[model samples]
Target: ERPEEKLEKPCAAVAPKEEALKPKDMDRSTSDDDDEEADGYQQKGVSIDDLSDDWVEAQMKDVTVAVIGNVDSGKSTLVGVLTKGGLDDGRGLARAKVFNFSHEAANGRTSSIAQEIMGFSQSGEQVLIDRMGTSTANSRNQTWQQVVSQSERLVTFSDLCGHEKYLKTTIFGLVGQCPDYTMIIVNANAGFQRMSREHLGIALALRIPFFIVITKIDIAPQNVFDENLAQLHKIVKSNAVKRQPLVVTSEDHLEQAATGIYGKQVCPMFCISNVTGEGLPLLRSFLQRLPSRLQDSGLFKPPSSPAEFHIDSIYVVPGVGLVVGGVVRSGRICPGQHLLLGPDKVSQFKPVMVKTIQYKRVTVEMAESGQHCSFALRSLVKRETLKKSMFRKGMVMLGPELQPKAIWSFKAEARWTVGFDFSSQSILNCALVSAHFASICPAAVCGASRNVDVPVQLCRSHGDQD
Candidate 1:
């Protein structure tokens, strides 16, 4: 009886003129019995129909780009220079700013998946990282909320591992983050190598559109750079890749790429030097205009739908307790809200209350779709302690409106194949084959149960059935 009353008061007192999923807590004043005052309040209310499309877009605009390439290809350096607003010293200085661990900095290799954001002003100015050191204690110079708050637009880059040993980690970052686009780094002197092809193939297989960037032009000989550039052009135009390559050297080429690069048909290539800052401006301009594909497809919009969050990574902070981190798939989440967290070992979901919500290390009022957030949750059931061991990868936080299930069993028809190998990932008779299907998507296979059909086809690999 008391819970019903508590819900009714918030619904009745707030005027519809307020933004949907208002970040700040709405004033919960006692209801008045006066008829005239009620009439005035009704006049101020606004509905979803009253808001324009532009208003909804202005509220949330986020684009994610995954930086992938072979080891020693300057992937991290490019991301560091782009977000940190600094150039390399030619001795691995710029990339040092982006490394997470001291060993990564010392070895000059990115071993883990790192994310850094760049905010763009309304007038087309790059928001550079300001200040430094552990006083702020974040990967970026300032907190993510501060950068996002100061800019009209946000661009997030997933700095992925490029070594052959970390191939699994690279795949997880690519499929998990669901970037709007992928930026493939190519070393001008070394040219496109084996691991570069692997990254490109993964991006292509997942149907993710991408652009190519040639780095370290300052040190590479002119002849060597041209040879690599020619090889890249030929590959993009080959029967396998089948995408038109546009070498962006001027503003005109940039315009052409911007108009048609959204799809997987056209591929844009850029040549830049981290030391000299040659083609950085052109890259920055394109990033500023790059549209969020999710927004264009109507997936990213007003957070009026039932809220959902998938936990991709988990952390147990010393002071904050256990925190789960992931991207908001379709709606908004706020602190003190109730959500179902689950499908643990026993296929059970525990109702938990979000104690705090932080986006990129800064506390935020509300986290919307397309933003990466960390949630500190508290169990709603009294005396129930959520053991960290129970929570597994691919768990989700669902709203009450959504009905979830733990599908421990399902039937699928495997296409008949001759001499096929099921030994790659041990995906014989399960639900998902690769990490792409494991990305915690909307149509997850309960196969994780949305009445969706997920089919698996085995493609030939290394002249062997796989």
Candidate 2:
């Protein structure tokens, strides 16, 4: 055998071994790099999972407030000013911005369950901006989605009707809409009207924490404002009500009020001028600081639990067959997940599949607990066109395990630990009746806040500015 041939054979064997060992060394180095990167990331105090913008936005905190008051008390006007960054013309130019109907605009009153969104950035900048800067004469409102997308924390206002004629709708707003807080608007000139007392009594009876807003200070005389303020302090602190008034004039007072707003007797009051923008900043700050009562009370369920959704309204989209919009009370809702939609007229639930989900006007693949979502649904059963007509507001959408047989009548024990009266009885009866009046539709409720006045769509996405 030749010496050269012998050398070549050994060299080839050595080459194969080296090649085999190379990938192993490379694999170790690659894994080491990943581990080191992950370690470095952890050291920085942030989760890699949270880097997704949608996830962060979906989890943003939102507070829902129901604005209630007597006729011409300025519920819509206050909301419009805060959200649109526009001042009222004293002729309800701002009020006209939030009206849901032509008649509402014509009359300058909110007659339905109307909603508006005002967002705050992490730095506390309002999400809304006047298209024409520094122009108080008019404001071109930004789209709700645009405001939502820009906001880190959102404040939702459910503007209920102020007139006695719309009392039923207001009842629906109070009971079914599930507002976190209620702001009772009082006219300084009126000095606490009849409906104002009724609303205050209702809030007290329901144990819903409330605050007062005295509007029209720009036109209201100082004596009238002082008189109304004194009246509020008197009524709120009375033995029957048992709440203390903390007039928020500074940051210290606001912090104190927000800290105890839930399950506490601290009722914060503000004097607001929708036209002159007096005391507006303080109210906005309070709203931003307002804690969510639902979140604190376990009513804001975690997404890990079984899904429970309350249907408030239904609509048929032109492109999509049927859609349901409501609040997701518990668990997670994902597109393509199977769920039960029911307690129909026959007290039976229908199996359904969620085809799409939208939150805050942005398309979402999954909706977590405490977010308002619209599910574009596909009925498991062969249903005809106009499937939406079959569903109603009082219905519940449940995860299979949570479904229960429908009952026409059932007796349950409830503890009425407080003093009761005929008014309370009527309120309770109204609650039962309102629960049955399932078609008082809201365009949608955005859960990230208790209810963002807006749209929920199934097989559809709704445009904003409601």
Candidate 3:
């Protein structure tokens, strides 16, 4: 047997022994009253080492969390501090490490989606900055591999654009990335802003569970911080969210908040400072204990079903002609598998061969459902022609057995906002509407009526020309 399998054997054997001892321990009570009293105190604490190995193995979870708020809320800096295990220098030192483009660094703002990951061991210890002597880029890649190989759980933070000009990019991250939770960063000095409320509305509309993080507490004055906290409390307790806001101040609060995160009974708030590294340990503890919100029934499709992979990005590697990076939405994909890539400008799928598969930059033979991976495609079309073809976003790769087609028109039942009256016979021109079915795409509202379904035409762009 493999080493992992052998490790599980001892744990399974101990469970039955413990079960047998339970009855004998209960029978030894001197009297019925004593037995009842013993039962009340019979609950035992199971440490990580004492639990079954299967439980430990199942602890290797992957959760994606989206970070959002208004501009200058220190979203990128906070993420950098958490992932790199370094405190900020109060002048964009940590955030500079997260920016991918020169313009973003120059402006000190993120205009696109940036992702960083943090890993926790079985003992709930972070393992991001343990490597020694490697260059910055190499260290990051190596750390990811080490974390995936050794850690018990991984949390991926998708830092999205917080500026108003890049609101579309932020919306795409929220609707397309399928994050398990959201962390809204609020600047203590600025209090609540318009863009922050916009982000909160989107999260609430999607029914995603979220928590608030008040940043820059080290620099903000006591009065300003308290005022900001009061405003946050008022908004969270309002009729819309109706959530009880709990201020996390201790390890006990962290444990309680993490355990009840999915219950939605309370919204935990944390005051942190990336510059001085204050309250970071408590935040890390909460992340380590945060359970994945994805249920087993909703995680993946049946293995017997047809494979479907959603294409979020397309890349042309130096030697590897065309590569597509996405998540496996259903079934499994292996090297040398044949799938159909579509829907082209002509609304048809073309056959393509999977040449190679990669997971976390490590080559693998097969990738199962619910895992993000990159697949190198051996296209039947010529390289130059393939570049000119329609291989952009909102495309998919599927088993050829199940034929698929591109759709341009669909009817949806939507609730009309208050004070917005529409007539069934009137055609609403240039009405920008965002829709998400299999993928997120903007559509033009062609026609609508009160108390009835609305017809919309999907567009590749948001402009009227589309």
Candidate 4:
């Protein structure tokens, strides 16, 4: 072919707007050069599949594990201990391949307490998902929904406020909404407190599998440990928990303890020290084993990150905007995502933008379940509106829904492990799903609170159409 015909055909064939091109454009053509370079790269022994695993991991989803327990019961510490090896800087999850934190502490310690925890997960990626324990707050409230959208698996672990003041509320909120495998941490020296019994009762009612970790074993007197174990046994037996509890006396003895406690029973105990790093390895091994057990029973459901946002608190950020606080209940939340604002049935949840994330009380880029931190939103939402949007107590903030009229109340199915009865009509101060209550429904009985199915409700109603 003629040289002119060849040149014209190459450019004209590819360019739909051939008439718009001039001879100047033809002489300066770089398209062929670009194609050659691209072809060379493709010919190099590397395929897209050969890219670094880290790059692939960034695009994949991740699993979520929620950490839950009463306040001061070592929930955060336990998380720190469990993930000590994964963090980029610190001793815990910070060293992991998927390390992400809301904020860094003064000692250069990364704060794992907020929505930032979600950053640890990498779907099908060889990264460990580490999470922290914290109450739901405004900033991280959108996490749950994010998790459901981005993850294939989720493990929600709740940490309840352990103070006697919030025990009932915390326990009630955790009742049927968390993980099937629960790790209940108790202060060994304190023995079995009344709240522990209450917590156990809720766990039992849900038929969730669980193991107990007796914290502060390093400081507990030998007799105290024994007494705690005895008390725990009595509580379990009295409650008739379907699964017997496993007890761990010391880290060194975890494997032996695990072997001994493998039967179907009530709460079992494991001795651990969050400060000393004792029993962590065994604990890790046990955790890794749980997924297998779930699979063996043909009941294996890879974790599902449900849409749940637990708001912690609401505050104003310096320059960003209105900020809410709390730990994510189920899924993950991202910086630019919008979330619903109100009640379950009627209230409409307005979509709001997530501006920033603050974890462990410090600001960061992203967040997820298990961390306790604050997050910023584009606009300020009404506090009451925010509260009504949340579903559970630990749920700090939540996506909005229809106007809330009757609170979403469910029947409490529990086995009474203590002397209390559900028959008595005394004012039963309780908190479920984070909303508080002091008066008992005239229908409730006393000590029979076990296996007691009580109708619970949310207070707010949906907004009326203008």
Query: Which runs in model 3 stand beyond 4 Å of their true positions?
Result: 1-60, 130-140, 296-304, 380-389, 416-430, 436-440, 451-466
Candidate 2 per-residue lDDT, tens place, 75-174, comes to 8888889878878888878877787787888877777887778889999878765352321212323366577778888888889988888776786777
Clashing residue pairs in candidate 1, if any? 17-46, 445-448
**What residue pairs are clashing in model 2?**
372-447, 375-458, 376-458, 376-459
Q: Write the per-residue lDDT of candidate 3 for residues 1-466, one digit (tens) a residue.
A: 1122111101000011222222233234234544343333233212222333233225428877899999999999998888878899999888887776878889998987887888888889998656422325566567667767777788999999999888877877877777778999999999988889888887776667889999999989999999999999999887777788999999999877976667777789999999887889999999988887654325456444567887778888777778888777766676656577776555456666577887766677666566678898765433323562457666788875565555544345554221112222332444445444334344445445443454333333332122
lDDT of 1 by residue, 79-169 (tens): 9889878788889887887788888988888999888888899898987646533323453435566687788888889999999888877
The TM-score values for the models, in the order shown, are 0.77, 0.75, 0.79, 0.46
Candidate 4, residues 168-219, lDDT tens digits: the string is 4354334322334556778878876666666655555445556777777778
Q: With candidate 4 superimposed using the best TM-score fit, by how many Å does residue 71's alpha carbon deviate from the native?
A: 8.0
lDDT of each: 0.70, 0.66, 0.70, 0.43
Q: How accurate is candidate 2 locally (lDDT)?
A: 0.66
Better of 2 and 4 by TM-score: 2
The local lDDT score (0 to 100) that residue 247 gets in candidate 4 is: 55
lDDT of 1: 0.70
Query: How much is 74 displaced in model 1, in angstroms?
Result: 0.3
Error of 2 at 224 (Å): 2.0
- Alpha carbon lDDT of residue 452, candidate 3? 43
In candidate 1, clashing pairs total 2
Pick out the ten consecutive residues of candidate 2 with the lowest summed lDDT.
Answer: 6-15
Count of clashes in candidate 2: 4
